[model samples]
Target: MERDPPLVLDIDGTLTRPEGWGIDPRLFDPLLEWEAPVVIATGKAFPYPVALCHFAGIPELVVAENGGAVYTGDDVFFTADRDAAEAVAREYEAAGYSLGWGPEDTVNRWRETEIAVQHDQPVEPLREIADGYGLEVVDTGYAYHVKDPAPNKGDGVRTIAEHTNLDLEEAVAVGDSENDVSTFEVVGRSFAVGNADDAARGAADEVLEDVHADATLGVIERVRSA
Candidate 1:
């Protein structure tokens, strides 16, 4: 029998239901029993995806902080310029805008390579400031991430693929936002969930009718039956 292709998934809006912030319970068993490696790629911090993989009983393959960090189970490495990201964050703060979280903000407490600002904050200004510092701002729908321009989900997935000895051209990826576009570009086939933003939909090879985790499950089913 032919082996299944490696799968790369986005966590937040792709794995979670539209009404909730957590992963849909429906995804647990399928992911846990998947024959091929599953990589969780997200704009979320490093620890979040790592923890999710740990509890899900999946390998700790991750592309976190929008590709600023990559964990290949045996080793972990960072690509984005943390110092540049921090400088942008500091400047953003000085411009009289709140980072959108409190002093004890858990949103960015563990973030190493990028800064995540709440969505409600003005994004244009953040983008301008990031550009001045030779950085970029990506809106993930949930938040605006200020980080290095070079490191993106594509780079992260490539790193994961390389370490796992998987063929990048045969991998499949699924996601629902702009941050996922990079991954879409790198994978052999990519799916954008029904609720995906325009950029993701445009980048993906196919746009699914189902939304969120349902779409992800559908993709898995499609791949399995192929």
Candidate 2:
């Protein structure tokens, strides 16, 4: 039985359904009440799910923008690898791919590859670049994202652990998409919930068949079992 700290979980498709449907409050309740910290590592913009965390009473670190943006309740840590995101975004745009909401520096995205392009970008061209990078490109049917090198979930997990003063070997992360693979590989324990993609489920130590499962509840059971 290993006793380790719990750190973060992906929100869309991992915890609740991507659209915020069929979520069991019990699933989130434990995470909110847990002695260990449980954060949300998602591809959503800073505010959308950040607001969800607020409503759920979650105070753990938030790894958003696929890792480009890391938020702790009191502070937000933007990525340091500005060059990669900007370069990536630039390459995609030059290929005639339009982007979604971000690229604040516009150059940061072309330089560091820190942002996910879905809100304002089309899916086809985004998929083309995702393939070009040898990175994982994910389409939640709502958004298209680029998380090949930097500013990914795994990177976000590391940043979160550092911010919380938690040990990497003490944390657990679970996700359900290809974008989650990087973050999934960085944690001590990784699990794929029932609703996850095959790549994600294969990446985890456990594969759950409980679609519509509660991420917090699945984790609570793991706590007891572990």
Best by TM-score: 1
In candidate 1, stretches whose alpha carbon ends up further than 4 angstroms from where it belongs are none
Leading candidate by lDDT: 1
Q: How would you encode candidate 1's per-residue C-alpha lDDT over 37-97 as one tens digit per residue?
A: 8999999989999999999999999999999999999889899657888888898899899
- RMSD over all Cα atoms, model 1: 1.3
TM-score of 2: 0.71
Q: Candidate 1 at residue 215, lDDT?
A: 91
Q: Which parts of model 2 are misplaced by more than 4 Å?
A: 1-4, 17-23, 80-122, 128-137, 140-142
lDDT of 2 by residue, 1-226 (tens): 5554776677677666534564555666666666677778877766655777788887747877778778766687777444444566678889877675544633123323345566456666665665665555566434666555545778877877777766777777777777778877887888887777778878888887665445546566766425
Local distance difference test, per candidate? 0.90, 0.66
